[model samples]
Target chain A: MSGTDDNAIVAARNFVASLPHCRALGMVVEAAGDGVATLSMPYSEALIGDPGTGVIHGGAISALMDTSGGVAVLSHSTGAAMTATMDLRIDYMRAAEPGGRITARAHCRHVTRSVAFVRAEAFDEMPGSGPVAVANGAFALERATDP
Target chain B: MKRPEPIQVVKQRRDAALRALMNGVPYIRFLGIAFDRRGDELTGVLHYDEKLIGNPGLPALHGGATAAFLEVTATMTLCWATLWDDLEAGRIDVATLSASQPTRLPKTIDFTVDYLRSGLPRDAYARARVNRSGRRYASVHVEGWQDNRDRLFAQATGHFLMPPRA
Candidate 1:
């Protein structure tokens, strides 16, 4: 890989590492590129909603998508700036397969002066397979100012 | 302000039924949400638990936990309201509801959450209202707040699948 691309990946990873919520949820940055990012969360018994079903709770899926959306926003960011989600909508298509790692990929579809729009989807085991949940979000971006 | 005597009497029974159902759900227990009844409405509380912290930098509550708390609250509110309606109509007896699970648990079809402010670490509160409910579907809106109700940390709207009442 080119040095510039490698540096961008490192920067992206470092940025995610700085968020406590991402770390607490066991979310890992798989890969990131201009306006796109992928994150994965491993299966854990503690995250199950229905012990009878053993499927991960919908809340866990929501957090994964929200985090993925933020990372995607960062990929397209021009400089270091603070970002927070203004709103997020999640549509649960199906339950995640039991005992499988779930991955979410988000793309920053567009950015306005005050907001960044993102779309994300979560899948189990494979990225190309059917998605377990899909989400669209808008994030408020505050650009850093020069001192 | 005081409610009418007949309404008050019915609410007492309904609130007790809802509390019992809330305690039976495993996920509700896991989240440690407590229900409070105000007339015909319900409010849920999520007390501070270190394990629920998602944003340690802000020392904030986990966004997922907040969403789950609201989702469960909305479901429970609909269940309670439906049961009250059935009881008033003499379609189901209070004994039947208290003795067994409700006809069915509400399933979420879609959920949308709006983050207005960072959820600070503390006992968070949420209240839900069923905008519309039918035999096959229900729509609910919920708001999460801390300290001041006027300032919400997050608000969510969701559509849930409601099974036909037996």
Candidate 2:
């Protein structure tokens, strides 16, 4: 990508980071390049649906997948766009325990005129292992119009 | 062994069962899935808390989370309606359903949510209009309402492929 394209991608990431929920979720853009972005969300007690058992909610995991996937496409397109999830399927390979940070690596597999396909995986960092939940997502992006 | 109950008997009972058959999902219970039920037309609310927030500027519910909820909701509706009786009976798992499916289930799917209007800062209300075709496939129009006002947070339509009974 040209320097201009790279700068546009950075600007897009900054814009998404400015969203309120992104900040609340503690989402960070770890890396962005080649139409892919890796985002991370720190595990917190607030994410615990079952306090006693300390199990992370599926909703929380899904949230991470959606944001990371959306941002990945946004960074790739380098345009102001609103994302709508056409379909998302999540397979819970294993339980995501509370207090364990989950990171999502999202990549834009394909981008059509109006639709973008993305896949992401959420993993907890342990001694030496990979992610837990693998999520596949598709997002439809419409060019944003400024008022 | 005692004679098994008639299929009709099981179907009748299923119509009134509220609990999700899938077990060990902590968040499903936390979200109060017990209060919800599936019908010819399934309607339910997806409760959201602070944890759902992803971006501070939007403070909006994450889109992928919304999609997963919709897929599960639609799947449960089909299960509750006993639409997949053949699959449940171990007749066929992939054939019959795949032939006549409504929503397409890619390994991964995308959802488009439009924030029609913003609602209360905390909770959002969502509903789905489910439609099924003669034991084949099902389609749903789901909407999320938030901020007292009816802002369309997310809308989804999904298809599940059921295998045929042997």
Q: What is the C-alpha lDDT of each candidate?
A: 0.78, 0.57
Clashing pairs in 1: A21-B54
Best candidate (score: TM-score): 1
Model 1 chain A worst lDDT window (10 residues):
A74-83
Return the TM-score for each candidate structure. Answer: 0.81, 0.55
Residue-by-residue lDDT tens digits, candidate 2, B94-134 = 43333333222111122233333333345555565556534
lDDT of 1 at B73: 80
Per residue, candidate 1 scores C-alpha lDDT tens digits across A35-82 of: 688999998776766444677778778888887887778777454365
User: Model 1 TM-score?
Assistant: 0.81
Which runs of model 2 end up more than 4 angstroms from their true locations? A1-13, A50-52, A77-80, A144-147, B1-61, B64-166
Q: How many backbone clashes does candidate 2 have?
A: 40
Model 1 misplacement above 4 A: A1-5, A8-20, A126-129, B1-20, B23-30, B51-55, B85-103, B164-166
